[model samples]
Target: MSDSSTVLKYTPAEMMIVVAARALAGVRTVFVGVGLPNIACNVARYTVAPDLELIYESGVYGAQPARQPLSIGDPTLVTGAISVTSMADLFGLYLQGGLVETALLGGAQIDRYGNLNTTVIGNYDNPKVRLPGSGGACEIAINAQRVFIIMHLKKRAFVEQLDFLTTPGHFHGGTSAQELGIASKGPQLMITDKALFDFENAEREMQLISLYPGVTLDDVVVEIGWQVRVAETLSETAPPTTDEIALVRGRLSSGKQSGGTGEA
Candidate 1:
């Protein structure tokens, strides 16, 4: 097929979703947040990976939405979803009870220790800015079989220690997280706009495995604003395939044409 005639090409954002979705290729259920993870899950369900199941923090499982949901409480999230359960039951029974295979999250501040701070930036009692308080993140992190973090990494957001322990990453370091009363498995992958990182043997530190195309290791280091470790051998991220790109563009175009869900 001619390059122009063939369909499906993913954009950088969609490519990021594709990379995130790749991890869900064989996952049976995913406990997800509402933003990028939501779109990524839908993309996975419709495209490359069909086995990926979505579970909302609101306790909706098997949520099969024709379009992306705006939030955990979006009607489509409840209506199109296969089953809706109580929030407590979803966490206590499904999550903490060991039913979820993966949980995806995003946070404002992530430390080298892998700890997340989504609560506040300044003081706890009287803070400078009171961000949305941590939701079921602590439970999700503690209960899920595995975890995935999708965020645009920057120095300020990636800190030395999160101001507040919104979600446990690693209590200390090197199996200390497990020893520190944390029950769930540590993060499996940390996907950023610049590169992808894998935790170093249960340690809170990340080792660079791959860098996105047109992104250099030095470029990543500069943007990180911290002393992040990169492996001696790093690979370049493969650009999105023509088919993947086309599919994403088609979805975007379709959304625009249909007066799509106006959720950013």
Candidate 2:
């Protein structure tokens, strides 16, 4: 296929990586959770940013792998990863000490205040549904110097109030999350499939910073359930290039060969 003809078809997963990678580029170290964060971090490491440091909640620090890890607790994460230490020290010493500068976590529900919920969907007493539950998300979000959350914004997920606040809302509408003792402060950026958003000050309300490639600002507003404030001057998030597509595909293929589905 001609290079010009190859319009990189970025999967939803790849789009997730594109947005998440851009978010992590300047960050030196990240306390990454599984799923999208893992893929995005690895993508950044392989493509644009090589100096990225990964500190898994599993206690592996500075671990860099050639391909996307199958899971957060995957043996591959520990096998070649360096500074493998006790899970206790990893959190107590490394995370608590603020050694981790950034964190990437997912959410079942996120409010305008940047608070996350990964516990139950319905009422606390008689919940309609129970999620996988928070592993190290609460701790990582609280302790990391900065936090990043990836959740597609939809009516079901974005609610006015969470039935249960799984992780502490670091910052409220006008409070500093760090001062509130919730650790990492509120989310620095919330990357959705439709658009990108960043919080304004301690208000903790997400402001539309940019739209994903091939997505319009209007589309973002229409898709989100709540009112979304857009930046006066927004920029289009650069889409994955052909080179990026090839690299990502090659890595994912290698992962399949090494016993991974590379599903996400």
TM-score of structure candidate 1: 0.87
Candidate 2, residues 45-89: lDDT per residue as tens digits? 655566778888778998765456677677677645659998899
Residue 211, model 1: lDDT of 89
In model 1, how large is the Cα lDDT of residue 136? 88
Q: Locate the minimum summed-lDDT window of 10 residues in model 2.
A: 255-264
lDDT of 1 by residue, 8-126 (tens): 53445666776786667777888998767876665565554666668888878877655556778877676456679999888878888888998888898887767788999888899
Whole-model alpha-carbon lDDT for candidate 2: 0.74
- State candidate 2's TM-score: 0.87
In terms of lDDT, model 1 sits at 0.73
Cα lDDT, model 1, residue 56: 87
Model 1: how far residue 114 lies from native, Å: 1.5
Quote the lDDT for 198 in model 1.
76
lDDT of each: 0.73, 0.74
RMSD vs true structure, all candidates:
4.0, 3.8
